[model samples]
Target: MTTTTSSLLNIRPNFFYDKVINWFPGHMAKGLRIISEKMSSIDVIVEARDARIPISSINKKFEEVANVKERIIVYNKCDLAEESSQDIITKAFEKYRNQKVLFTNANMDRNIKTIINIAANKARENPQKYPFVTVMVVGMPNVGKSSIINSMRRLGVHRGKAARTGANPGITRAVSNTTIKVLENPTVYLIDTPGVMIPHIPDPVCSLKVALTGGIMDHLSDEEVIADYLLWRLNNFSNFGYVEKFKLPGPTDDVNVLLPAVSKRIGALHKQGCLRLSGT
Candidate 1:
């Protein structure tokens, strides 16, 4: 939706401050330590990722722990991200023959079943080497890691949403592992891990935007820049009504115009009838 500088300022404060600052907790460190200890038992690593921002969602430390293990990258939340981005992510991971990538929407029970089957088939391919296949589920917070596990447990029997789901990140906190025997040929054990939030490595503002907005597009300087950019990109789509509803003025290409426009919309004014664009 297109939001004016003033309106955005009114709705959200601390325009320059980073949104949802994330830090690695002691529990996460303990979980990682546990995963490391059991790394040898794992036959395959199932890495779950947010389809919207695959790169940002992945935990960098995973590569070190997953060294030399068969890995499968599952792109969750396909319904939210654009189809083109999905294709690009899938193709990018295709280069690794040992790593199988699949796109799925955890909310849909059927899709989750299919993913389980795909994971089973891939695990069974090299059965002679490893008799028991251990699959470790890893992903960022709120990426549906727990939901995927509960769905698999129901075996398509329960359709209702049972796993804890929310917009606020870092809901899953502990690691839960279980075993499932498929067709008596391959005994697969799946490990569900707590969501891990890898600290952002780049611009703090950009990182905040992703945490708050749930997706990262082109970088913008301020709230106005973000709103304007979103408006321009979504204008061609059928959802441009937000622009008119908010009565926001058309945005200029310049980033300098954003701060003042947002300040004015939010009534950030001082005693002299001038806009208080800075210093709270």
Candidate 2:
């Protein structure tokens, strides 16, 4: 294990290192159009964000489409984030009049009932407006939009998955004709759209944070840079669980030292002589 420590490592102010990330694709454009067209019928907008990177995960483009709708901010993957940070995140959205913020672990069904109830309650306000409640789940790539719908379906209707789910980004390309039914009483349905990312990231810092959360495509950004940013964040926060997980002698801020030890421990090897640690 590499145990040599150099002078105090200054946290990198930026992770992009002057690299530009182009992540928006044709599918996202079409998805945005579909969402815009369907917003008239959408009674409630369940904006799902990655709880770990709550602020950075916000798709700025969504503000135009979702500003007028009844929005509930569901910060999914709460299990992956520090519980102490939830209150601080929640306090940021206190200015919104009709918006509700919730932290949920969709995989474990935690707070799924509350989400459904909130949406259902909001939709029920106007019984004459529509026959059924149409709720749209929206967010950046791989922030668990489909997973939240699937969880709500399993709990609300006791049914199988209505939306396809995966760990990678951009699984659902469009809002299909078949909307998933999450609640039967008063007739509630969910529209699962493709994970939408902002067309232009404001800066390199925002790009790296979004990329680290898997919001942007992995190939578009250097994995080593992303990994180094993660290490810097963890070390800066004094969180050193990676030391035990990677079998390192102690915490190290250098990605060069940590990556090699992790690669050897995880047996990551490329076909050629170079070591591959992309998925680590």
Candidate 3:
């Protein structure tokens, strides 16, 4: 919410919401290339991921890209996830790399201090060429990389925001740098990279989950498909709140049967886009 240090030229498609769809665009192949190229100088690699879907949200090739650097996992938006699940995920991630895992809510500025301390200590102990501790934050879109930077700036630096934040995808387009000095001792410079999804996400369920969770652009997804996948997941979990909420007679796995009823109940006459009523 603070003033950004640098203005991000975030371009978004402002088109009419009338029955138009497209595949996921803005693949930042260059972003990954930059991360790989810049990893040589980075002391610590902070992989920011959504706390809700810890394992699914992380990039597939992160281990390969960040293999050389000291890695620390920062599970952002911890407030939305269960504390018990966070503990399990943290422990599960321990074997991959002997690293400290931190769960943080950048929005609330909670547990962010621990993130800075862990990352800073790791950087300082490793001894890099850069005088200050150099840390690069990487994650898929909408995973809260920018918010984490702002959180660090607020508590550690108490200054302006280094990276831009938005509710939608593509808020961060390029690599941005802003240095925040932690009050304690080591001055850490955080480099915020553009959110980069894997080039080829092979699993359909994984792709749907990512899109539904806002990791990918909404326009790139079929609304019906997203909703259908969501319904399937809800059914699989044995959660039938939708049946009552939508005023359906009984639980139905069909999105078509449920979407129109809810749409009409909410006085939404144009029940076309964002949800398909027909079972075509």
In terms of TM-score, which candidate is strongest? 2
Off by over 4 Å in 3: 1-27, 122-131, 177-184, 265-267, 271-280
Encode model 2's per-residue lDDT on 1-280: one tens digit a residue: 3322242356555444667576889999999999999898888899999999887888878888999987888899999999998988777677555468899999999998987887677557766765688889999999999889999999999998888888678888877767888998878888889998888876787788888888887878888888898998887676777888888777877899888778777778565635775563
Off by over 4 Å in 2: 1-16, 95-98, 122-126, 270-274, 277-280
Sort the candidates on lDDT, descending order: 2, 3, 1
Q: After superposition, how far is residue 220 of candidate 2 from its true place, in Å?
A: 1.3
Give a tens-digit lDDT track for model 1, residues 67-100: 7777777788788878888667766766655567
By TM-score: ranked, best first: 2, 3, 1
Q: What TM-score goes with each of the models?
A: 0.65, 0.89, 0.78
- The whole-model C-alpha lDDT of candidate 2 against the native structure comes to 0.83
Q: Where does candidate 3 clash, by residue pair?
A: none
Residue 83 CA displacement from its true place in model 2, Å = 1.2
**TM-score computed on alpha carbons, candidate 3:** 0.78
Report clash pairs, candidate 1. Answer: 5-261, 5-262, 6-262, 6-265, 6-266, 7-265
Give the C-alpha miss distance for residue 166 in model 1, angstroms.
3.4
* lDDT for residue 17 in candidate 3, whole number 0-100: 24
